[model samples]
Target chain A: MANVPKLSDPQSELLDKVDVFIFDCDGVIWRGDSLIDGIAETLERLRKAGKKMFFVTNNSTKSRAGYKKKFDGLGLTDVPAEEIFSSSFAAAAYLEQSNFPTDGSKKVYVIGEVGIGEELDLIGIPHLGGPADNDKVANMGSGGRLEVDPDVGAVIVGFDRDVNYYKIQYAQLCINEGDAEFIATNLDAVTHLTDAQEWAGNGSMVGAIRGCTGQEPTVVGKPSPLMIEYLESKYGMDRSRICMVGDRLDTDVLFGTDNGLKSLLVLSGVTSEEKLLSPDNSITPDFYADDINAFFASETATV
Target chain B: MANVPKLSDPQSELLDKVDVFIFDCDGVIWRGDSLIDGIAETLERLRKAGKKMFFVTNNSTKSRAGYKKKFDGLGLTDVPAEEIFSSSFAAAAYLEQSNFPTDGSKKVYVIGEVGIGEELDLIGIPHLGGPADNDKVANMGSGGRLEVDPDVGAVIVGFDRDVNYYKIQYAQLCINEGDAEFIATNLDAVTHLTDAQEWAGNGSMVGAIRGCTGQEPTVVGKPSPLMIEYLESKYGMDRSRICMVGDRLDTDVLFGTDNGLKSLLVLSGVTSEEKLLSPDNSITPDFYADDINAFFASETATV
Candidate 1:
């Protein structure tokens, strides 16, 4: 129950300790379509200082290329598609690293958007069953027998806007009846898009499939250690030298703390200082800032 | 810990104690349009012997009228619509009995099918927002803003073929933003429509809404005290003298045992005798029969 320290001024000593910094997008670096002020400069400065950097996001609605497009739109010249590690990309990377059969027979049944399809396509994992017609009246099957493709070896659940009974039924059927691996992008309770509204996250869809099949899936996003493990092996980043910087507590903060990396929380998006400092809250960030810009306000790079 | 006695002959002693008999339809009386042999005769004999009868089913896809239609097709002349207590009817009956203000403004946001809609209409509780077009491509909102109607005082979840992200989003928005009563028709894990395939039941939909909103809804169907309490209060049925008979142990048997009523398990449906005799299983029925007809095949009911 220690008090969460708020770094109003730049803490160069803490910043200097990290070999690699994983930044969460949306709130920390950008909001929707707009980049946060001084973030572009901070990334450039950090890169010039020989500090390795990557953007880790739970947003599975977009693929790595799609995230790169957003970074490009923000005029981030150095950050390419490889630097962005989204849940979508993580899902794809997981399949490839697991060596999920290179034989032409195996495929993935996707219950998500184009981002999931794009990511799977990037890794040469042929996927089917994305964006099915979810019209309620039209989908009333006579026997309720879901068609399961023999080629589908895994079922990937992400933030599906078209998450319907048909998709869930098919997903559950594939997982329950067949020897298919069940994987989820994230298990966020509610996704904060704006200050006013919190929409149903991919957890709802994943939870529905879970409820139907009475089975748990391997979550591939934040706090799961799958993405962190990916980064650790791919970049060969030391756990002690890596820092996770983000805005959310459950996803971003827990992702860092659970994986032995330091977590830095910003008040720019979801978490307020009051809740962060509350006694009941167990998940706490190592350091807090008003925003990503505030974190490095008066710091000179170690280089 | 006790043995669930498999009754090959009539157990007149157990049947003699109960004044009312409640039957679960699908597995007990009929299995998808094909009536179980001698079930109609069993109902008629039970009715002739002065034992009151009612049908309690978790299938929310049918309204009371729709259920009556199926009953009529099966030549169940004695079983009126009033005797059928479906989860849909239970949801409406609970709302109506609670006097969920009939004043033209307050309504329920239904995330279910036409059956639930019909039942709510029968009770005169107006509803909106069900099974909307949730095609992932078209549903991307600017701020994840859900269109919550101010007049919606409650959100009812049931077996929905069109259970989609849009309906879930609206239901979550209404529950999170407003003081709306969250109600679920049932929470069956997997509704076995046929012997080979099991469809995702109302539990999946309810759990999705629960996952999105982080709020548990009041379940009105089997095993929940809502239906038992409704039946008890409405019929003034004696708890000790009432019997719940069904094939499944989870819904029907649990519904009885959880309450004070005696539970009778029929083996002609889902549960095998080995499971009933399993030492690991804690849920035990008061009596067991091969089928409904077998229960009354050899003896006369106590008048």
Candidate 2:
């Protein structure tokens, strides 16, 4: 376990003394295929100073292996594949701990991409729909998407670029009629990558399904206990001593606040000063800075 | 608005159908204590000619108001109010309209009595606490009831027999919350009578406060638009041509099903076997038969 000191609420007063700098990839390190401002240099400086750091993103649009390749292309070549954590992986870990029905014969319905679907397969939880041999895709077009069938007991929702009415309807039907338990990989309403336009993320879909079924899903990403659970299982991190450094409040700040860990919100992402003032954004950050490099430059103690 | 038919799918198919009987009260005849069953021998003998009927029960408690009153004591004396409808008025209506928040209010922080609280209240919408004022009077000695809080946006529920902690919480903070909405004047959860047993009604209290709010309530009376909205609002109903008849879906089957013309659920109080088996229980009936009295014993016609 890392010998991180326990910081009182007092420690959160300063903006520095953050030894482990975690960056959220999609909106922080890079957006789509392009790197964000000073991101590459920040990573180099943080590493040279012997500070431990990692990139954690809840975006399940790509697999861990895919993220590794993207990072190498972005010139953050020294970052290890092990440092990348995605909500899809967190979801898989959650299912594993939950003793998910993993018999090869049991089919699990997935409403997401290769990253999410592949995670289910790796964990031995069968995918109900996908291109894999065991997959049982509904292909309901845009209208049948929300139609739920009892045969599908578990629903895995992730970021899908091609969401249409049919998918929503089929998923709704599955949830309302089939009584399928629902899970979303993350709660993001939109991702900054793939252009700056807003797109519905898992939260919007979950809201629609909840409207009909009166069910709230267990989100598997940051801010959700499942992510922390996965981290503990993978690295044996001391739950009380760890801290989360990321940009977004909905994900990173929420993750830290909800789990009792310290959070550092970087100003390099989609969230802004105005958003922090809103009552709906329940979580508050422990520290903030322009980027990873500036964080260490301040050299201010957390307390 | 579409010219949709009001009967349930099964009942709608039998165009000129009228073979049984049922009823619900609250809205059909009287507002609170006033009798809407009316003064007419016209209410009896719908079954003597061999029409089958039985009251569909949603109340779960009470056995036949001991078998009938209100009308018997009010000197509209020819009929029986017990034979009109089951006390599960709110539940039956809600079951039909389990959709979205008609406004933005989601969870109902209820406080009231047995008929208004337990079974019916919990069916679809999530409820935060026990039913209010009236319900306390109804369920004394049962145990400690959950208290209501300001976080609750809507207070729906009814009557009570031993009002105390539950009622205080409801009447004080829950309703006083600025944005909170109050529902329920169907105040009489259980009406005490000449004998030891009590009869339940949602008048008195529900009616009193409604007068103050001036927000004409969506009363779940014997047969109000509220009940019909279940079928018509969702499935579409033909108001001009449809008819309802019963001893009681609430007070009378024909109440909401009546559509301003023929609302009659026959006597023997609530319902009969023929009414239970007929499609109108799910649809709408044209006429009624109380006990052995059939109103249109030898006729085949539309209202």
Candidate 3:
């Protein structure tokens, strides 16, 4: 029932008006490690046409520098570190902007992976309990109490493959007992682990802490204005001239439309045409396309 | 503001009318490993008065045999294993009654401790992924797709000390992608790990899966009526004559009142006098007592 238009033409008026294009990397640019067809050339065309590019991803498992390495590995060698905005980097940026305590007096308790910790380190925010506490088990026997460190000012929960009971319990204790700020890099329920299947995302880990603490985390990812606010503040970009392009509706499209940016939904990833056109689908993107390659399809066809 | 009367006298009419007492172990009989004062004498007195006692605990970490061992270690040598009804046992009983596959055509995937697995094994319900999967990390690297076992018919989530990302992901895959039944032992948010502190309970673990699957689990523990249904079916006890005694308001008190059983709230566990008296407290027990010891306080005083 959605009245979204298909962006088939390379010279579409919507594409012409957009000064900046904010893209979600995993689904839009590539599916797993394989880059989408014509995406590299489309980016080259967009850049030649004087459009600013920013790759925004809710994946908190990798830092901006780490993301740059992934980009390089994936043959997107020109994608600068400054243009890559990961949820982990946004978390660190949000904390820095909020004037969070960076000294040894107070630190962050990470319920995530190395990426979040690495970003925190970049911002000079002291932290503990990420990969370091992954193997640590809770002593539930006699005289077993998870000791709460008095120095934890915030608990940053992100996508962690190493998430366990000890980290979950420790995060819960820090938030409930220690009165630490609860922050989630993203609340994405599931993410595509590969081209084959979807896996549990950071939201699952955040849900555990939220369950015990009876608290809502300040989400620093897409659909949450925190990441956009960070981007806008850092780059001074015009929101009206920016178009957000991605595959997912709940995070990517909602992130764009909610924040006053135009959104384009691509069918090359998790979502399909049936899903987009479904009556039950609440979120409607401004524009729909077969894929990001649709941007410069005419030129590619002519070639 | 609750009009619950104090059960101060042994000759109280409510105590005399009850034939069976369903007690929650953690906050009712003991705090951690240390037994509450006079609980032993209280149980003995109740037994002498021809009252049947059953300890119903949401703690899924221990099986019935394990609980019996703990009871004997705590000097309650007379307490039998048959009288102990843990959530883990309730889960097995529920599955067996429901006629779940036990001939190995389909098995259960446990997102809990050994207790749940042990109970499943007792009922001849084949299961996998408990403490054995504790050290197993999810392969988030290339070609990392969580291989869902085709034999998994149900995913049972309990209070697991060894809960990890791999187990959580596998359970989600089983329920979401594999069409397996989602079952939770209990959903208690926080439990008394010690008298000094409350730790994240089974609900926290359940919450993580709930987040990813977007599915409500069939809870088998307190207040769900599943445990009582299992108990009633097994023991043929009259619900009206049974009194549920526990320290917690949500699980124990709610379980009793919801199941048409007389409820007694003990102040010795998680719920304090201030909490019980608060207008915010919605759950109201039929009677309140200092502890189970209050049952024969006058006799103890004389001694």
Candidate number of the best DockQ: 3
Instruction: Give me the runs in candidate 1 sitting further than 4 Å from their true place.
Output: A8-12, A132-144, A192-196, A278-282, A299-303, B8-11, B131-144, B193-196, B278-282, B300-303
lDDT of 1 by residue, A253-280 (tens): 9888999998889888778888888888
Local accuracy of candidate 2 as per-residue lDDT tens digits, A19-61: 5545566656776667876767766766776656667877776
Prediction RMSDs, each to the true structure: 3.0, 19.2, 2.5
Better of 1 and 2 by lDDT: 1
Given candidate 2, what's the lDDT at residue A25?
69
Candidate 2, residue B292: the lDDT equals 22
**Highest lDDT scorer:** 3
Runs of candidate 3 exceeding 4 Å displacement? A9-12, A278-282, A299-303, B138-140, B194-196, B278-282, B298-303
Q: Tens digit of lDDT per residue, candidate 3, span B155-208?
A: 999988778889989998998889799999988888766555678988789989
Considering lDDT, where higher is better, how would the candidates rank from best to worst? 3, 1, 2
Which prediction has more favorable TM-score, 1 or 3? Answer: 3
Give a tens-digit lDDT track for model 1, residues B226-245: 87788778888788998889
Estimated TM-score for each candidate: 0.92, 0.48, 0.93
- lDDT of candidate model 1 versus the reference: 0.81
* Candidate 3 per-residue C-alpha lDDT over A1-303 given as tens digits, one digit per residue, 9 for 90 to 100: 666778767476567779889999877999888888878778888888888899998888889999999988888888999889899998998899998977767899998878898899887989999999977877777557888788899999998888888898889889888879999998888877665678988878988888788889999888789867776888897898889999989888988999999899999888999889888899988888998878877766889
lDDT of 1 at B48: 84
Error of 2 at A200 (Å): 2.2
TM of chain B vs. native, candidate 2: 0.47
Global local distance difference test of model 2 = 0.50
In order, the TM-score of chain B in each prediction is: 0.92, 0.47, 0.93
lDDT of 2 by residue, B145-216 (tens): 333444555555444323222343343344443355665433333332212222322342343223223333
